[model samples]
Target: MNAGPISATAAATRAAARQLLRIVIVGHVDHGKSTLVGRLFHDTGSLPDGKFEAIRKMCERRGMPFEWAFLMDAMQAERDQGITIDTAQIWFKTEKRDYTIIDAPGHKEFLKNMITGAAQSDAAVLVIDATEGVQEQSRRHGYLLHLLGVRQIAVAVNKMDAVGYREDVFTKIEAEYRDYLASIGVTPTFVVPVSAREGDNIATRSQAMEWYDGPTVVGALDSFQLPATSVDRPLRFPIQDVYKFDDRRILAGRIESGRLHVGDELMFSPSNNTARVKSIEVWPEPSDSDARPNTVGAGQCIGITLDDQLFVERGEMASHTTNPPVETEVFRAKLFWLGRKPLEKGKIYKMKIGTGEAQVTVQEIEHVLDTTDLSSSTTSKVERNQVGEVVLRSRRMLALDEHTRNGRTGRFVLIDGYDIAGGGIISMEGYADQRQLVTQRAKNITRVQHGVPTDERERQNGHKGGVLWFTGLSGAGKSTLATKLERALFDRGYQTYVLDGDNIRFGLNANLGFSPEERAENIRRVGEVAALFSRAGLLTITAFISPYQSDRERARKAAGEHFHEVYIKADLGTCEERDPKGLYAKARTGEIKDFTGISAPYEAPDTAELIIDTSNLSIDQALEELLGYVEKTFRS
Candidate 1:
């Protein structure tokens, strides 16, 4: 028997089956992203036989010079237009490991395609023309890479031959771009000067520039470390479907991370259902008597039967009891919009994360980012091809992880009328994981009804007892209004009290801190206390910067009909200028963490019973309106 020679594509595929790293090359249009990729394959002898010759012969017949970029721009339209309009993927190898280089388009109109490539890459190569230096698209691509959480980067200063291979030219571009990246919290691993078209300093060092001494482009790529394997991370098996074979109910899904074993305890998230894995099931059972497997790791598709008949369904994630995904109804996302129409607040869109899909509403657009200059401005909507920080709300809780923690379950896409309009990475920065809060731990509890009637208490006090919950930024004057209103009610022969945020923290909520979880717990405890005070025939006023809308909703649920939300409205500028306690200054200077209207978010009420704009009205005028409303509504 004779063994046949393997084809280049087959050989590359076999090599790719081993350890591989994904790298996406991006830059401004005509900056040579595709050219660098093509030169890399040619220099490394990674191209198939006759592939280069065919391209060169075609260019000769067409009366055009042979272009290195033609090796990557395979599409006829791209070659005709002299620009890459889509992402192109190819496989090559270095002595160290196999590589999948993604050539993403550099044209501004094709940014969505660029984002698609960058999202799937483990690292990135940013190309810039040595003669042109940095351009608008260069900064935009750099910012997008950082937004997608690609930290390992190498900047390739291509077209160095056009600039005569001057070391000073490369240094100037390096310093300027490095500072820009650092401002956005990214540090490139290396910046190498190369002329991809001339094949200088790509695979080998450039001999033309004797003043420069640094690693070649290949060296920079080889230096990037591979990300930690998924198997070593926590388990996250999203239930894709359920199959009933004979009498066994099998839960089917792929192991996105970690490992699972037979008899291990599993907890399904967003539902909080628990059961033990009865058996690890696989098709075509092992023929050998002792060949049955009992465990599975990341990237394997398998099914398992649970000991108990739990009502598990698709969209629920299975994980070990110790480390589960965060369960929440609202979360923050850094999203890139690609829809022709802008993404507006209060509009509902379908979100797909892992195997789960849910309808999510755009709660707020934090800010629309200017990728070219890295400046952020408040906007009502996110325009096409723009990146923005957004808050999304779902009616039901969803199981997910922050992108920084686990990339597999942390990313999602938005579908609008059957089109992928946007995509983003999840972040729970200013929100709490509501798993513990939603779980009712008490085994036996009963409500005790009050003996006294509310009408009798109101007759005795000459007014109805209720809670006036004032919510706003810290310097919006919630505390001042609450204290003054309490005094006015007392002088008018009404039983009244004020629960200031600072005063409550000193005693009742002494154990609570300013963390998202602690802040939620603090609001929960105060809501219950304020409700009790209302039931006792005293007008209770609460002054707290309850920044989260969900937290305020919980408080409203606690008080029911006796609650009246009062919104103290003031712009961020006005509050900062007032700076009663100088807290905003401290927050800007990094002295305070998670400070509302500064480092943290402040969710204003959309259904407040009364809205007082403190910026426009004096304290006396605002108080008069507040007093009139209370007197007209609460007087018996």
Candidate 2:
């Protein structure tokens, strides 16, 4: 008999069954993670025909007990070492859908491999030895999963047969692990007691655990829904490379998120250059009969030609102007350190984010996290295999997103010399997105030309006008140096004035708060006023913490050649020891929010005109050097 036509609902269900889900299985060493995956493949009849028999024969020839972990541990080194050293991926299926099971290594030495596996998975299965309950590695694995943004998790308490399948034992293990996972903001979907060796509670309900009423492992696996597709998110096409082919310049990259179509306007970030997509191109050009695709979504690797000949380069991110990625030089990060040496503050490392690379310094280490107990402590360094909250500063602006916003563009790795030292997720917790602040918004305003020429003013004053912008951490002696320098310049009959931070805030910027945006605006206003003073043939001295490099750059642009960046350098420990204003104490006591060198970030100048190290130099010595430099440069 011929079959009838399939209904729409049945056809949709069949299509859904073909969809693939990637799952990473992680746990402590010898916790049966590999065994669980092997058993799942066997129970579902998804293994190759002779694969199972070959494994049994090998075990018999070696005079060893038949083991399920051997099914996934395929490497000769793994078999000899009796441990999985790398991430093993295999395909398996149930009646409902297909799955890619990634068996991640659980040994502490191979945790980086596990992290790589978990990073590519949509869901996770955390295995635990029932006898061991929750080990330190178990808690560490759970925290790593959370850090990788794996929310859909199932905990399989293996080795139940070792404990005689006791209901209290299972309950105790489940309760302890559940509490630990909850502490790190991870609530597992289901906690099932399973004996992978005997196939209990793995593919079917276990008869031995009669008191247990939760779904089996297979049932829980089928219950997880796929995460939202990247195509639904905003467009983030980072230019990996630029290919010049004949007459066309093809911008090649994978669409990290969102969609791109022919004629769509693309705004390249960090550069802020715009262009229109002229045509989409693919390799092995289609025939005349085959219509070329006009649109492409996330995950597709394609190239496109633009309408204009723009100087686009590698490391530029393409996005819609309405929803561009956050442009910033400094951002907060939650880092997982894996380096042999501890990650220390003020140390420079190469950061790879998206397709771009930049040199970033560890501006501050907020705290080192104890993953096992979910406790945090203030620290100056993050040790190997530890996690910490850090603030990283880059010299140039980076186009990125917060991890919660877009995982693909939000993750990055730090390279120490040649090895991968750490990986982290970006967060703009206390930082501002500087896109709007940096972009020019004012329109149609004309500058009033001064009647007096600058040279004429210089002739009258016997010296050229200039700005000495002193920037550093609090207690770095910026105000002290600025006041003394002003007095010395006055004694020499040179016109000079000091614009201290407190004095400016008392009047011109009193309405502005200490928020990142307000701080940028405050510096902006002070920079303009200082520029006016310099234009009037007077040396202007401004003393402020002015933490962000971008703000300082703006001030330099406003003053042109007259701007001189003077870095009053002092180590944080020395500044705290001085604590001249008692502000550092207030910041430590939680009385001040967004305090630089305490809770906030302070980006030291990379190419300052002069650096005065107050930590080592006496007040008189620093002042003499400063006065000599000013006289030699500004005096005609």
Model 2 backbone overlap count: 0
Q: Write the per-residue lDDT of candidate 2 for residues 509-567, one digit (tens) a residue.
A: 99999988888889989999999999999999999999888899989999999999999
Task: Give the number of the best model, judged by lDDT.
Answer: 2
Candidate 2: give the clashing pairs.
none
Q: Write down the TM-score of every candidate.
A: 0.89, 0.83
Error of 2 at 281 (Å): 1.2
lDDT for 367 in candidate 2 is: 85
User: What digit string (tens of lDDT, one per residue) describes model 1 on residues 487-542?
Assistant: 98899988899999999999999999998889988998899899999988888999
Q: Candidate 2, 200: how far from true, in Å?
A: 1.9
Instruction: Give the distance in Å from residue 177's predicted Cα in candidate 2 to where it truly belongs.
Output: 2.7
Residue range with the least summed lDDT across 10 consecutive positions in model 1: 1-10
- Worst 10 contiguous positions by lDDT, candidate 2: 1-10
Model 1 TM-score relative to the real fold: 0.89
Prediction 1 global C-alpha lDDT: 0.90
